[model samples]
Target: MPIIELRTEIKASKEIVFDLSRSIDLHKISTEHTNETAIAGKTSGLIGIDESVTWRAKHFGIYQLLTSKITEFERPNLFVDEMVKGAFKGFRHEHHFEDLNGGTLMTDYFDYESPFGILGKLADKLFLLKYMTDLLAERNRIVKDFAETDKWKKIVA
Candidate 1:
């Protein structure tokens, strides 16, 4: 398994960052390169505890479907989404937010295990980890953009 941890400081309230982080609409915008879309379950809006979403995305030149459910959620604080079905063996993404200097410190703890045993390990060591990290970093950048400006109003209420 490989883990990607990122801490992003947004000059915005925790509530704003938290909600923006869970916005499906914002996700689609940030991942336009991957053509990611929520095709089932909670397709739009802020996803909450017990909510699931099926995402269809183009990754590595192939389209894949991944279903993830929010297993944990605390308003304006923390949330955890775990994969129900996907290309990987499994994955868990935990989003945490806290107040800092009148702003919010958003952290992502993403852990994932790929399929195919040794081949998967090789992939992680080769390019998968960095690829995943870059993907998350770009997503976070978009979240920061929305949180720091008036853009959030369009996606988060």
Candidate 2:
């Protein structure tokens, strides 16, 4: 099991940050390099509790399909999405938001278990961990970019 935690500061309201974070359209934008897209289940708009999305993307020179469901949600505060079906053995991503200096402090806690047991552990030690971390960081950067500017309106408004 591996856990990756990240905290990002955004000069915007929690509502805006929260909504932007859950916006499926924004996710597709952030992962454009991988050609990620929602192929089914709440393909557009902000996803709420109990909603699921199936994504198709190319990662590590291979194309994979992943389906995740929002199992928990608290408006403008927190949400949890767990992988129901994916390449990974199992994974859970929690999105948390807090108020700071009239802005929002967004935190991501991603925990995942890779497949193939020991081989997966070795891969994590070798490169998988960093690869996943960088991916999350870049995703957060894109979220921040939208949250800090008026650009968020195009997607979340």
Candidate 3:
């Protein structure tokens, strides 16, 4: 298993950032390249505790359709989603948020494993890990930008 932890501060309220993070529309907007969708469970609106969503997308020439269930959720504080299906041998992502001097402190913890044996390990080491990390970072950047924008404030308000 490969684990990744990343943290970043955003100039937005915890509620604003946390709400945006759970919104399917926000996810689609942020990951436009993936053309992702919510195929099952709560297909729209803001995700809440115990909700699940399936995402279908293409990455590295692989068409992945993954379903994840929110195993843990605490409003404006923490949430965790674990994979139910797709290409990975195992996958789990935890998101955390904190109020910080009128801003938000966001953190992500992701763990996943690719298919196959030695080949999977090699791929992860050479390319997959870096690619996935970059993808996560880009997603975070989009959320940060959207959360801090006046447009977001108006929408949230």
Order of candidate numbers by lDDT, starting with the best: 2, 1, 3
Report the number of clashing residue pairs per model. 0, 0, 0
User: On a 0 to 100 scale, what is the lDDT of residue 39 in model 1?
Assistant: 100
Tens-digit lDDT string for candidate 3 (6-103): 89899998888988888777777777897777777787778787888888887877777888888899988998889888888889999999988889
- Which run of 10 residues does model 1 get worst, by summed lDDT? 148-157
RMSD of 1: 0.6
Q: Which 10 consecutive residues of model 3 have the lowest summed lDDT?
A: 148-157
lDDT of each: 0.95, 0.96, 0.86
Model 2 regions lying over 4 Å from their true place: none
Q: How far is candidate 2 from the true structure (C-alpha RMSD, Å)?
A: 0.6
| Backbone collision tally, model 3 | 0
Which is the leading candidate under lDDT?
2
TM-score between candidate 1 and the true structure: 0.98
- For model 1, what is the C-alpha lDDT against the true structure? 0.95
